[model samples]
Target: MDAPALDLPFDAEAMLPGLRRWVECESPTFDAVAVGRMMEVAARDLALMGARIETVPGRMGYGPCVRASFPHPRAGAEPGVLVMGHLDTVHPTGTLPALPWRREGDRLYGPGVYDMKGGNWIAVEAIRQLQRAGVATKRPVTVLLTSDEEVGSPSTRDLIEAEAARHAVVLVPEPARPDGGVVTGRYAIARFNLRATGRPSHAGARLADGRSAIREMCRQVVAIEAMTTDAATYSVGVIRGGQWVNCVATHCDAESLSMAKRQADLDEAVERMLALRSATDGVSLEVQRGVTRPVWEPDGKVMALYETARGIARSIGFDITSQSSGGGSDGNFTGAMGIPTLDGLGVQGAGGHTLEEHLLVSSLVPRAKLMAGLLQVA
Candidate 1:
């Protein structure tokens, strides 16, 4: 027998107003008050969708998180679908006023529009459409909107993991790839503070007595850059050194990141960074580990989930493909726990975390329909 029909009634065009509002809010990750305000806006909307909204207190000096559960007619929260996203953005609070929201052709440009305020609205629109059709989802659906994802999701990681443990699959709408693909796996990332300490002396009068920390740091930077290969990377992003050119640098500090395609590769990269020795005779090198995100490799279960989602997408006039992303998301955390996850299921767009960020307006409805179909099916 043929499968029953599915009618996804979300008007993609009508989503502009709400999305525009979210973009205008400017909920930057670093601004506590602004991020909290944005969460309130989302909480009100989620409550209107018959969801039970919970305010999870923010940790480590960040804004609060919103947990909205839209229960199934029967199952409630018993092993359902988990939707993950963030209200926090990389742009500051004043970015919206200067950048503003505008559309050129099919691209909608604004702060946080593509990096994922648009994707977040896709979830809301999906729920609204289901309610309008009087369609009950197959299982409970939980939406997690955190306030600190752009700066590494430090506050929301534990909460996200705890919630994901109660669900079977995690759907991360982290803005679909501009090339029309979803994220199946992501690279692991490790950050570090590389500090070099050395004796300071006058550069001109006692050059031989001076042990330059900046020179040692430059040598370490060269070594780290040499370690960058196809499968792994080590790049120094920021550096600081002596105050004056006439004095030997007493201390030097640098921030670097290591990215790897696999756990073993990441481990190797970290080992290399930690083992780095000072080049100057009197300089000492120290590395302090900062934020680390595990690689989300495509395991059996995650790939299986993608297969089901691909079939649904094909039925809706779009043949979806799954690909690996170099950037990590919250999916990396859950995937580390061996939970099935599919990231980048959001609207298609380009230039995330940049001024040119935009969403392909044409993708709104079809992608929303695909998401609704996934939720309705399971």
Candidate 2:
């Protein structure tokens, strides 16, 4: 098996220090300065792989993006492969002190390790190994590490899509499924905010004159809940209204979200939600559609890409399987753009977006090898 499996040139244990360095950096999505620091460190590491690295200013008001271009050995015929990941984590600042980066037995625990920072290193290590082996990539490889993915990729969607459009394939090293599965399709997500407006009046003193926005929202909530069915699921996460028990609420707001397995389901669900109007005579409803991650539905070409990757894994003496994700990634944008994309190609880990997040130390070498092999051929 040692000979059959793609042997890593460098000891996998050596990779842990870099992982720790990244985790300790604490690059949360909301902190631009912190995320920028993380990107700066990543740019240096990516530059070591003989890539011409550049920092793209964050146009979406997030942190700057790090793009590393590895020139192909051969002149460009078709667009090369795009290796993409995000630098942002759901964890806020000061999380490292609380969770801390430490290795116990076979697990590395810290913020951002499992969700994505680990994935970033895996991709970087793959390229590092490739460069060390003197193997020139057949196609140019561009590694784009965006700073705002955990918060919905507001600044990087266009960048990811534009880059993927030119590439033959988009390789996203998002964290692997807890069971070591990769991802082929991801659900479309649309965040929504519904606000109800009404006139305020003293509840007890002028009960007949009051039209409660909270009551209007309550009626609309029934319709919102009903919108969840087999194909699409919807839920309201937050609700705020009313000043006191004696006063009718002039305003009510609800933060809701919907996820669909298909595009039609997403569109239909959004339309229905937006159609929700005032249930009370004097109340009015307003719907605002927030960040939307389009569905990454697997088509024939993408399936073929998956099959190719499955074969690559087989060559390395491992069985690779892919699953569909309810959550979305930058892969969604590329997949929606009809680019051949593969995701969850990063570290094998669980407990993403939690203080318990960890990456399997044993998975580092094998997953990195898989990425290297894919880069060599794809």
Candidate 3:
């Protein structure tokens, strides 16, 4: 495999300022006000590259999603490529005080630097490079930055899928693997909240008369845990019950996280959950199941996209490999829409969803170059 020719004139200095501006803006998902401000910034930056930008408002605490695009200069070339990322961070307001970004040698440390802000900036820089170099492609490019990706994209999945269906390719800038590989497939996730209610009685006076909802909850937990198999995994992440140590418990609830490789596996898990019956007679159970996101299966289109990405990476003096991850991202939605999607194109780093999250500063230029090349090819 030969390296792709790099024709774009990359401006590292220009990208630095844009990255700083984006990172400084607090775009936490739960903070609609702050996220709105961040979207404004993104819109402003994107406008400079002649992208037509639009903001879609979200409900309640959810922030707005920004959709921006730069059409191909030539008409009727090919279906455009859609670059997907999120503007919101998991950190809430005041978290910046604790996760202040620092430059230690070649690493950049901050709350959302590696998790995605850095990747977002890279996408912007890549577009800038393409515009500056006057690279003409038959395919146009659209960037979709949402506000609720970290929290499972509950409100943005529909928008993502709809947009993805209109494109020939979807590029996700989620943080790449620590070893700098792309993510081809990701596991599917299903979350359930189970509540059991039973009659309450005095523990000392009428122990037999009162049904134990807590005990029934334990039985359900065991049954759910038993569903975990080689291809699927389940966890009882949270459990709550009992008013006091002495009082008879009348209510109980448990939250479980389930992961599956296929739809059949997920169906099996859900069926098992639905089959659960109260251990004690007269006790009632209620279950609320929610699917946070669907799995990104590795199909023919995805495999072809990976090959293109690998060729582009090699063109930039790097070798690229891809693997299926148990983790999910916005790419899952795009892939489910039958679009060829490639993810994990951001700077290499580790420790997402933690205080130690960081990015390797050296990766910025090469990754941006790779993206610029991809845009040219698209």
Candidate 4:
């Protein structure tokens, strides 16, 4: 069945109001109540453009995943392109004052504006444009928005992979680089927690009898830090233990960050971590977590998708460039599934996860137009 052609006018500026509203609403990870409100707004906006919206349940106290779709014009065509983004931000309920839309010349300041509430709006506007122009795409279209991305997408990773496998290509609307280049490759992230145990004793009286868990932890930390090489990086981020100044610490826990360029590096790191035994005979060790996201290498299929995206950008008078990043995203999950994924298709800005996070207002319209054009061509 041919879907009805849409002729709705899509103004990039027209999306700013809604985008700012979304940014102002604090939808932090696992805040199911707040996230539900945000999803309601998105579903309303998408419905106006003739989209069917459904919420995919999530586990582990994560926000819901939304799937909005517009059927293809012709029956028995190829599957659709999936325009993906997330609704969650790193900010809690009120980490900083929720900055509304502020235009200082050509920049818009707000939380998750560029890092990616703005990107979601861009995708919606693009689809609206294609429908309004009466363009009959050869495939169906789906936009999957998750609410757990800022927190590593613990719950929606499976849903994302499934959607990506069903699509022709996955376009991630993460914020572009400050230089306006798209991202073609992203690193995998593996976050782990390490714990050590020791007997407690009075520091002044029985210091010799008590084994220091902190000391054992320090040895393991030094060993892990030493494993960092050019291809991979590791950091002992947090350490917490000890009861009193005059007492030998009975327990110590530490968290580490591990990055790898390839899967083998991750496996080696995990093996090393699991092999960690207490340096002191009296102490014990535990490895709590392991690899979270796999590395995303851009193979030939991914490169071809990027080439097509670059052509779409060129048609809209935007010269797009690609680069590799050590940071991970949902794109990493999709790319690891052997699906062609391209990221950084949103506004270009910097200061992510900080107070200064802002988006270039000038880039918003052009990028939106480019994305809209890509949907038309795809």
Can you give the lDDT of residue 181 in candidate 4?
84
User: Candidate 4: lDDT of 47?
Assistant: 78
Two-way TM-score contest, 2 vs 4, winner = 2
Instruction: For residue 170, give model 2's deviation from the true position in Å.
Output: 0.8
What clash pairs does model 3 have?
3-315, 4-315
TM-score of 4: 0.87
Relative to the unseen true structure, what is the C-alpha lDDT of residue 134 in candidate 2, on a scale of 0 to 100?
Answer: 71
lDDT of 3 at 372: 74
Which one wins on TM-score? 1
lDDT of 3 by residue, 281-345 (tens): 96898888865667778898789888888888887789888988777789888787678888998
Q: What is the C-alpha RMSD of each candidate to the true structure, in Å?
A: 2.5, 3.0, 3.3, 3.7
Error of 4 at 70 (Å): 1.3
Candidate 1 vs 4: which has more lDDT: 1
Tell me the tens digit of each residue's lDDT in model 1 across 1-378. 012224666687799999988889889988888999999999998998888999998878899999998867655526988899998998987787666799999988999998889988997898888888777777788999999887678788899899999998889888887677899899999988999999999999999899999999999989889989987998998899999899999999999989998889999988888888887788999998878898888899989889988888888888888888887788889888898998998989888888888899999988888788877775
lDDT tens string, model 4, 200-227? Answer: 9999999999998999999999998998
- Best of the candidates, lDDT: 1
Q: Please give the distance, in angstroms, between residue 99's alpha carbon in candidate 2 and its true position after superposition.
A: 1.9
lDDT of 2 by residue, 30-110 (tens): 889999999999998878767898999886568999889886765367689999999889899988787898888998899
Candidate 3, position 58, lDDT: 86
C-alpha positional error of residue 39 in candidate 3 after TM-score superposition, expressed in Å? 1.7
The C-alpha stretches of model 4 lying farther than 4 A from their native spots are: 1-12, 75-77, 98-101, 201-223, 238-249
Extract clashing residue pairs from model 2: none
Residue 262, candidate 1: how far off, in angstroms?
Answer: 1.5
Cα lDDT, all candidates: 0.86, 0.85, 0.82, 0.80
lDDT of 1: 0.86
Off by over 4 Å in 1: 1-6, 75-77, 200-212, 241-249
